[model samples]
Every structure is written in structure tokens, then in C-alpha cells.
Target: MSTSPVTLLTEDDSWEFLRTQSVGRLATAVGGEAEIFPVSFAAGDGVVYFRTRPGTKLVELTVNSRVAFEADEWGEDVATSVVVKGTARILETDAELAAARGTGLVSFQNDDKNVWVSITPTEVSGRRIARG
Candidate 1:
């Protein structure tokens, strides 16, 4: 069976695709190496918010704020992906944290104190592929 290749996505389509998912891969680079981690996120007011533990990964991200976040959907013969290029910043203020919490995306079911990270997208793109 032949597989279809990825397609270039438009800005509006990319944003719309992202709105359909609540989790995506967050890609970052440090020491010339790249890393991509799956993260649960919420989008609001043109910002993406997620919670992570405070540690080395967080430190590395702070030092290199530029990142790419992606979310996608797949079916038997079709797939769609959305990618967002942006800068990430730690939300330190109580107000900022509270606002994120208010989004109701964060689960209080867990005991971990959530540390919020916000990604402001500078570029967003998406693609859809189908096989007949």
C-alpha cells in the first residue's frame, strides 16, 4: 500500500484544528539537541497553557523560550495535523495562575501543585492528508 505525504497547512485551518484537541507535543531545543514532549494544554485568548513540574526541563525551556507545539488526528485513510511556533513563558503571578486554573482545564484530582506555562504563537499552520 502507498502512503500519502504530509501537506502544507494554512493559518486559519491550523488554529481551527488545534481547537479540536486538548493535548499536543511541545518541542524545544537545548545544547543543539531537540526534545518533544506530549503535554495537555488549553487554548484561550490566543495563548496555550499547560502545567509542568519545576525542574531541569522547565529551566531549559525558560532559557530557550522558542518552541513548537503540535496536535493532530488520524483515521484509517486520513490524517490532519496542526503546528504552532511560539515562545513560552512561565506564569509566576498568582493572578496568572488563577486565571489558568479558572479555565477548568487543570485537574484538581491530582495533588501536584501545577506550574503553568504559556505559549504565545507567532506562527500557526496545519495540513490534512487523505488516501483513496
Candidate 2:
């Protein structure tokens, strides 16, 4: 058990936390502007997968592959957050598509989200905040 109110989680712990969650925010930059979108995601094997339509989110990610993703959960007095700084790429190969599908990622909305995006995290960090 941690004594401190704020506990830093290891990379493995962060990924494990992410695996339990299905929604996150994907942040990207395009033309010096920052864009963030709430996404339904799945995580496995050090990769985060999400489905998106051919729209702003897709275009922005293409222009800037560098991205930051965040997922969090809040309880009565404790909150846990995980941040993943990574490179985002649209899955093109059959293997990549299969892998993304293997994670069982599905769109929360009934949209034609045929495009799959995978974020390979270069750095993953998380923290737990507890109020006493």
C-alpha cells in the first residue's frame, strides 16, 4: 500500500489500468492548433486502438503523428489517470487491422468508422490521487 496521497504508477500498471477502461481522449496537433477528441478505445500488447471516420480527427492525426492519449476513472475519494504519449498511425496492413480487431474495439456511436487507428506509446505514465 502507498502512504502518499498521490501514487505514481509504473508503465505496466498504467497499461493495465487502461485495459480496464474503454474511453479516452486523443489529443493531436494540426497547423499549430491542438485538437482533442473523446474516443472509444481498446488496449493490448502495448498498443491503443480506436475507430474513427474519415474526418477531422483522422486528418489531424495524419498531419501530426505525435499524439497524447489520456484515460481516467474517478471514485468516491480516489481518482486514477493515465497518460500515453505516442505515435498514432492509421492501420493499413492486414496484420495491423487484424490486431486492432483482435482487441475488440468498437465505435460507441453508430457511424461508419471503418478506419482503425493505433497508438504505439513511447511513454506511458499514470497517477492515483486520493483525497483524505
TM-score of each: 0.82, 0.95
Tell me the lDDT of model 2 at 71.
Answer: 98
* Local accuracy of candidate 1 as per-residue lDDT tens digits, 38-115: 788777667778888877669778789999998888999889988889999989899888877765674324547467
Number of backbone clashes in candidate 1: 1
Local distance difference test, candidate 1: 0.80
Worst 10 residues of 1 by lDDT: 104-113
Best by TM-score: 2
Candidate 2 global lDDT: 0.94
Q: What Cα-based lDDT does every candidate model obtain? A: 0.80, 0.94
| Model 1, position 13: C-alpha lDDT score | 64
- Tens-digit lDDT track of model 2 for 29-116: 9889998999999998999999998999999988899999999999999999999999999999999999999997767887888899
